[model samples]
Target: MPADTPTPDEVWALLTHLVIDTRDQWKRAVTERTGLPFSRIRVLRRLRPGPKTVKELAHAAAMDAPAATVTVNHLEELGLVAREIDPANRRQKQVSITAAGRTVLNTALATPDPAPASITALSNEELRALHEILGKLQH
Candidate 1:
């Protein structure tokens, strides 16, 4: 490879940094707009599809059982989530987001990010090509 070209490791490092920065920015924006903690937002996002048990929620949110329980308790107190005994197994609890929670999520997501308008400078063909490349990497 030419000395001027970046190595694969260098490219990966740049991509990793970009992803981390973007994610952190997004989390900050969400918190500022919604006043919800990141842990609660994480669980709320997971519950958008449907209700889930505490164990299932913990796994989805990458949290341990104890942490999930605490977060769920907080969300419950906020009226953002509700819990009920699982019909399939009375021993477990199913957690689901409330309508109020959905409203908060929608409001937070509707807030604009600080993405550069220069991204729109790319031509349609260029954007399509970039989309294809990103799609390939995603799979």
Candidate 2:
């Protein structure tokens, strides 16, 4: 311990706080701009690549099966998603985003977040170093 360095606990606290703050910021902006709730946006994002059963969507969206069904139902009514019976399992409902959903997803994601002063103040070297550290933690 160098006096100038933050202890691990202090670093974790700061990192989690910043992550939550940043997530909340864009979550709100995207929801407002796309006129879709965050849950719907998440469900749409998960379906962008391909269709998934409602159970899969529930796992990806961090919700229970019932909630996922409700969300998918709303998206379907809005023409944002299409639901079909999974061929492999006739009883399971598979959901996929519609063409209009792609448009909304793009529009929602394209909404930019202005860099906060703290980030803007960092030098390229600092940014790279921070990126490297975060990448390590992810692994």
Candidate 3:
């Protein structure tokens, strides 16, 4: 380690800052490109694997039930998602991304999230080291 190695608290702050900053930039880009809120895009991505009940979606998306319902309602209006009565539990509704929703997500995927200036300024060796270190982090 370098003599100037960051303290644990400093490392924590930097990690959290990087996460918030990077996520904000990516979310902004995706929302601007797709004309959809980041939350909706997240829901659509979560549904790509398979259909899920609104409760399950809320849980997976870390949203409350009412928020999920409002989001699902908007997407349903746009025909981006389809909600149907759950055969397993008729009281619950299952939501799935429509073909149009997949197209929107694909469009969102094309949004460019350019590297931050600090990252772009790193030397090739430093970038390689960062890549390796990040890979070693838990998924």
User: Which candidate's TM-score is highest?
Assistant: 3
Selected candidate, larger lDDT, 1 vs 2 = 2
- Model 1 stretches with alpha carbons more than 4 Å out: 1-16, 116-126, 136-139
State every prediction's TM-score relative to the real structure: 0.77, 0.81, 0.83
Model 2, residue pairs in steric clash: none
Evaluate all candidate structures by whole-model CA lDDT and list the values in order.
0.86, 0.90, 0.91
Deviation from truth (RMSD, Å), model 2: 2.8
Model 2: per-residue Cα lDDT over 21-75, one tens digit each:
7677788999899988988888899999899998999998899999998999999
Between prediction 2 and prediction 3, the one with superior TM-score is 3
Tens-digit lDDT track of model 1 for 1-139: 8999999899899877766666777778889989987778888989999999999999999999999999999999999999998899999889999999888878777777765444467899988997898899999
Model 3, span 1-139: residue lDDT tens: 7989988889889988987777788888899989999999999989999899999999999999999999999999999999988999899889999999999988988788788888999999999998998888856
Ranking by lDDT: 3, 2, 1
Q: Of models 1 and 3, which has the larger TM-score?
A: 3
